[model samples]
Target: MTKNHNSQHKDLMLQNSQKLDRLLTRLCKRSGCDEEEEHEGGNESVLFIAAKNGVLEILEKILKDKPGAIHETNSLDQNVLHVTVENRQPRVFEHLEKYLKEKELWESHVARADKDDNTILHLAAKLSRYKPRHIAGSALQMQWEVKWFLFMKKKMPHMQFLQNKSRKTPQDIFVRDHEDLLEQGIGWLKSTSESCSVVAALIAGVAFATATTFPGGTQEETGKPYLERHPAFNLFAFTPLWALFCSITSLITFLSILTSRQQPQDFRKDLPSKLLVGLSYLFMSIASVLASFSSAFFFLLRDHLQQVVFSLYAVAILPIAYFGVAQSPLYMDLMRATFRNIPQSSNRESEKLIL
Candidate 1:
């Protein structure tokens, strides 16, 4: 009896496989299925053919029978959805969305990118030639991703940032194409983009310099440099100290601003102002680091090795600054994501109509 049961199970599995294949074949041959063969000259494939005919009903049946069929890659190693997008057929999305919605494919496939490092969202955005349909469709797809992300966030509150193979967060890529949407929906919620106005380090320096005095040329018992009580210390002591403090404080704050995410409101209002803000901070940081080193060299350089060390360190400053400048564009995009809004489907549709 056990042997009979095992044989029956095997036979049933084989039957199911055959049934699935036949369903796929029938779906492929439906009306409006002029899609090219698997290795044919045109862009369409069998999976695309099934999708293009508005035969989503049959496609759904096949998918239900053989769930893994969607994972099959073509000669280009692209998943079915990727092929669907490449074909630029709106009807393909109709069937694909149905399959995805029924299967809850959003969370499962959210991070998947095709051969060209393009995610489904990326493909949708690239379907620009299809205009209003593609724009509206892509927005829906993005909304699905955002919903899935929010669901995951609720379930896993500790999830700080989601990273992909490209070392980018979903927000990173999303903001690149939909900056305003991100800012409106999510960017304002984070505090990393707020501006800092106080020059903190400079204030501290001024206070320190005001407290010291060289009095009466009397060397202390410790044989160290002593202050001979002088009125000059009382009057000008606070001035040098304050200047030094302000310089240092300004420098640190400037560096912080440069490295911080650029605010979208600022960038959108005036590109030059945003740029000047960055340049001002970068310049201040460099000058502050240099002034600190120079002060240490003149007043605190205790040994010959210190001079050599400062010189060697100075050599690295420009190269480091250059690399930081090179990465400015990427960080600018990230900052914009925090404050910018993505255009809505209706607006994009209207724009397409205008075009």
Candidate 2:
């Protein structure tokens, strides 16, 4: 049912896009103006608005009908590339790249600056007014911002050192524009680390206590666990040990994130990777702890209350399953932010946009 609804929604969007394209085409013809020409009231041109909002279909249709529209600029003297970069429209920028490459106008088009002498790189350095809906936290957002800046820097290395009217280079502009985001990212990382570290410490302590205290006590003569010969004994013996190791590792990983330098560059990979590791190990420790408890319960009830063991297992699994389900989105986002390739031409063939 959901799939059908989504398909219907997509079809509606497509139909609307086609209607918009026709309306724009007719409006251009009637006004005897190019698609790049601004309205009488200084409103943005259809092409620039499409690029800014990431309306790829509309932008493509206009560009296809009027190939020269790609060169048109807004009132600020910012071209399509500048507008796309400033608004963080990767798909539009990628489509424009294809057009530029086909026309053999890469150098001439990409090097153009706006009225403020801000190149595409400079615009990319500036943070967009709105955060992307798909990205979650400030730290991941900063990572994406860094990735975009680096991607553009790779595309036009010669322009990296170019200064705007304010005599600030792209790197300088990035630093100046992103100071608040950087601080937010640091606070986010530290807060997350502190919270997770406390949980990890608690899990480590529980696992340690469980491991030290044998189930059913020790036999008087041999000093061995009374339940050592039971099938469930192995689970009770090993799971707490595993849980202990995993919790300790998780705690250390979170501690590392807390003590990190928290630089802008660190958010690109280091901090996120550490957080991912810490999270994964913490989950493992939780699962192991649950398993150890279940196994110990089973060891005690194996003979007299065998049927009750299944109920106990079910009860033990609910929390772990709930935790996994609840945190899956964050885990997935962290994994993508940590390991996903930064989009650039060098790796363009293999790079898939996470945005």
Candidate 3:
């Protein structure tokens, strides 16, 4: 037997299952060759190897051949599910776990411990010990950790309180391992909240000034604004007042975020909740500020309506439309994602986020 065959077959499974099938056909015809046969030093059976590498099809096929192979262990005595999580193969774990349940071995397979008495839940939380390259941002990294923790809590409620040989529960391990990630998450959340607050403050200042300054100047004796008799001037007065209100609300909302306690748990609902409401108020302020500008400008140029006023209004409303058009999709996504009630049992991937 060429030593290259097992290594070659493993590589084949990773790249193309079709090519692996062709290679398996030839390998199976030869004498004394088998997928389940272990290599030297009790290295790894094909089943454990596939799970570690996330070759789901090969893992499934090997299990089909020997139903009891679900209980097979590696040199470290870690079963396939443990190996899958240890190697950071979450997708593999999902598929493999479901398969074990289908085969009526969920209890036996998931409960098995490794040499150190660390079960699959331990391996899942163990992921926080190292930062993976694919999870790019700190906030998202914290979210991923929460997602894993929740999944494990739902799957094995007893596992939360179960301590390993190191005497650390899974939650304890997460808190210990993800200290840096948690700090970064706080920094990112505050930075985002403060930036939005600045925009809200500027809007508040401008709208307040616009509300106090009458467009056509005040009447000489009564001290009431000129053009107050015109119906459009009421709109001119009210829109800026409306804008000022929304801007103040937005400013207050974002300021509260800066003062909030920056906990990892806050990111799940509290932070996103504030962000959604703040953005909504800011968007309202921006639209109303533009409306106020349009109405006031219209009052000044009302005499020129036939010639230049229509063109001027269209030119002025561009910024409001631009702000609306640009931010609507993001606004909609935040509203939907932050408020939706996802079940605890389901493993949900985070949505594509924009900041």
Candidates' C-alpha lDDT: 0.45, 0.82, 0.71
The candidate 3 region of ten consecutive residues with least summed lDDT is 346-355
Backbone collisions counted per model: 19, 0, 0
Query: Best-fitting candidate, measured by TM-score?
Result: 2
Query: If both were scored by lDDT, which would come out higher, candidate 1 or candidate 2?
Result: 2
Deviation in Å, model 3, residue 120 alpha carbon:
2.9
In candidate 2, what are the lDDT values of residues 16-62, reduced to their tens digit? 87877675655445333543344433557788766665667678888
Writing each residue's lDDT as its tens digit, candidate 1 over 40-102 gives 434444454454333444456657878877766654455776555533434445556676778
Stretches off by above 4 angstroms in model 3 are 1-69, 72-77, 83-98, 128-136, 218-234, 305-337, 340-355
Each prediction's TM-score against the native? Answer: 0.26, 0.85, 0.68
Best by lDDT: 2
Candidate that beats the other on TM-score, 1 or 3, i.e. the better one: 3
The TM-score, computed over Cα atoms with residue i paired to residue i, of candidate 3 is 0.68
Give a tens-digit lDDT track for model 3, residues 1-355: 5779988988877777666655444333221234334432444666665555445666677878888887777766788887777655566778877887887888887788888888777877765332322443466556556666566667788777778899988778777776888898788768877888999999999999999999779988999987898888888889888989999999999888889886766766677678788888998898888888888877667676659778877887788789778877656555654564321222121111000
TM-score of 2: 0.85
